[model samples]
Target: MKALVELANKAREVSGVRIYKRNVEAVLSAVLKSGDFWEIVDMSSLPVPAASGIVKVLIDEGILFIDDEENIKLTQKGFDFVRELGIETFEDHSCKACEGRGIPFYANIELYREFLQLTKDRPKAIRDYDQGSVTPETTISRVLFMDSRGDLRNKDIIVLGAEDDLTGLAIALTRKAKSVLVIDIDKRLIDFDNQIFKELGIDNARAMVWDLRNPLPEDILGNFDVFVSDPPETLPAFRAFIGRGIATLREEGGVGYFGLTLRDSSVFRWRDFQISLTSEFGVAITDIVQNFNHYITWDYHSETKAAELAPVKREPKTIWYKSAWYRIEALPGFKRWNEPISDDVFYLDEEGSTT
Candidate 1:
């Protein structure tokens, strides 16, 4: 038991990624519950790399071992360690039907099919922009959910930060919103979205390129009823995407939809961000749905740190990356900052593995 705590402390000191004692406890509990490598990571908030690093640490120290089937299993020392830690069993607490997403994946079944077909030839996600698109189900569900919350219908919406998921296209297809304006740094995505708008005669929607790292254009300030984005989680990225989103709102009661992932963020980081938003921006967090956004594994995943560091060394057979959906509303007297965001680590953080 003392050794396990010491190992976690050492990992915190040495691993480039954040490693709390809870991370060690989570991996150990996940191992007890499932032998499959992915199941172990999925059972926790950890990204694949973070989970793998903990498992590898334990394996090297003889607390865990790979079984004959190439599955991860605890050794005698591992069993003893878990017993001493008083974690005799592990149980998954997420909703079984929605897979803990808090909403049915097929909430908007018809739109999903159309959006899927509409985006079949869309631009591939490029690392130059740190792009990774969400599943079609997620995109439609997000729009529908916003409408349910009275934020979508007839509202002029701006999709800033990143449009790689084609959320702007999905929003335009609904014809529920008055207008959709998409702004991103990636020209290919902007071109792809504009072409879709033209072919379908979607006069209500338009896409353009604008790097979010700089201040937004003066002409576009305070020009929308709502905003949506799936942005990078670094503090500066949050300011660029979320701060700018709040500023775009023409008046109070305007809503914003965005996704945040645990893969690149820890609870401590999340707490700091929440404090910043509520205290400085004067917004209310109306909703947070866990694992609501599922990312279809990208083509370049095998070359990423997650793949290289995984102890099992196998390809993912199913969707693995996910994010939480957050809905924020601009309350009366809400504050907004339109200044440029400057941070060298805007795209990557110590807890980050996917970017």
Candidate 2:
């Protein structure tokens, strides 16, 4: 039942709806008490699109049904599933750490705080808009999330791109990992990360300048246990970054973490990427955490001429963009060792040209 609830929660997250677990539980409870399994409930009654996604998952698992009227009905299997869940008497409990906010509390808060302080003076985003950095807290959360997945300790981790130094530094400061490597196209970011490591007396992490357009360096190929990236939202860029990340893995049992947002990439694009990863690259997506990143926006277009400006009323001041974090694993027996590299440009402006 817990596993099912978790899956339902993920489904909700993937639906791009900001909803709480308690609300999802409410929807399930309502469905169960509506008296008849054959009766249709209004889809609009669900708190978010994730409820709709859960229904779809249930239907796919042979536990629910969608009738001709587009109404949701329960199958016999669904009844048994629900009965096992004991939904009627189920009680939703809030997380004590995040106060039901879903953010996990770190065991060593002081260390995390220190790490944030160290990275406070990191470089700002370039004029190219090549990088939109997230808060230091968010990066630490990512490290903790990865640790929770049992992917961090004694592992050789690599960051495919390191626009934000907080992530690599957090991993290194923990001193649990064997080593940390950060590769980026931006020389300034690479230099900054290395400088942070040097100043802090951290020995396990190192940064290098490497563009994703070319193949990974031979020395590092198939050397890492895990790869982390926040690639551009475009398909070509995603393919290039993820493909390169996969290529850097140890052929079997290697994992990759990345961030994708619905703001730029749609659900359909996500589905296509998943298929490509699983079918073409032999990488299977294991988990996706929604709203994992809260990026702080900065103005990079102030220098643009008025003739090139879009008809916006004012600059956006609120932090609205969020990313869905993905965890993918390399399967055994097959590998894409000889995949051809493309020379396509990935970072384009809204008008579809390089910024």
Candidate 3:
């Protein structure tokens, strides 16, 4: 498929988004699986920007087209090409009960109801921070999952590095931990969490405004029993968030939770990333739940490259962003990093599109 590789390369240049021949193949297969633009976006397992770029290039090659109903369609030639490539769409076997997160915490009815009400006016995610909030159900599930995994329930200390979804708020509401500390670059989130803590007299919880790209504050370092974050998937960003989380651990056996996504990282990239987490930081990966954390589209999504590069002009009517949640435990003699990351490439990377 040298010809297809060249086409994906051409599309990459035109769109200034990253994609591989596999992405081109994925676009065509996504179209075959579903005709709707948004559904194809979800099916491709690639960000809208990269998927859009590949789809446009395929259309130019007469491999794909928009039907009269505005649905994505493959030409006869496209079908033959797919068959030659041995690409086939299959049924989704992920659990429908918990959306494949494997944790049905939503069944806990009361926590969902309480968290939904508390976060009704939390904060709108801003593009400036590359921010998007997870659903209230996801937040509650995260907390409950922690409890199930023996990380919560009177856990003396917990930390969240760079939070906007207010998982810290949900943790505080549970009253299961003695203290919860939230650190983020955004003062807006810190103020919101702090305000909620004060109003409810949640003395065990507090928020701080500190960019993790800089050195982590000394007092909190090596002081937490657990850490949770949903940082950007870029390597530097991961180190900035997860590395700081590691530094906060009081000792070995301290656990951490973070999110990674296929949209922004290839499985090969994930391999190297997991290597860094385990080797460089001396932590053991405990769990990786695919599509565990679902994200709501930001209001500014229309202003993103994903919208700009989409082959279709239709707006999305569904939440199409998700990430795998990772749980790591500090191994014996775990390394700690409190060093400043002066590099500015903390958020955006070639493989990362939606941000």
Please give the CA lDDT of all the candidate structures.
0.82, 0.65, 0.81
On lDDT, the stronger of 1 and 2 is 1
- The CA root-mean-square deviation of candidate 1, after full C-alpha superposition on the true structure, stands at 2.2
Q: Which ranges of candidate 3 are over 4 A from the true structure?
A: 1-22, 47-49, 68-70, 84-86
Q: Give lDDT tens digits, candidate 1, residues 1-355.
A: 4565677766565455667788888888888987777667767778655787788788877888998777899989889888988875568678777667666657777888888888889888777777888887778778878778887788999999668888898989888889999999999989998998899999999999999989988877888899998888788888889999999989888888899988777777788878877999989998888888888888877767666667876667777688899999889998877998776888877676676
- Per-candidate TM equals 0.92, 0.67, 0.91
Greater-TM-score candidate between 1 and 2: 1
lDDT of 1 at 103: 61
Clash count of each predicted structure: 0, 1, 0
Per-residue lDDT of model 2, residues 185-303, tens digit only: 88877888899889878888998888776767788888999989988767777777888888889868899999876544445567788888898888888988766676675455344
lDDT, residue 354, candidate 2: 11
Give the lowest summed-lDDT range of ten residues in model 1: 9-18
Candidate 1 lDDT: 0.82
The residue ranges of model 2 lying beyond 4 angstroms of the native Cα positions read 1-101, 105-107, 301-311, 337-345, 349-355
Give per-residue lDDT, candidate 1, residue 325: 94
Considering every candidate listed, which one attains the maximal lDDT? 1
Please name the candidate that would achieve the greatest TM-score relative to the true structure. Answer: 1
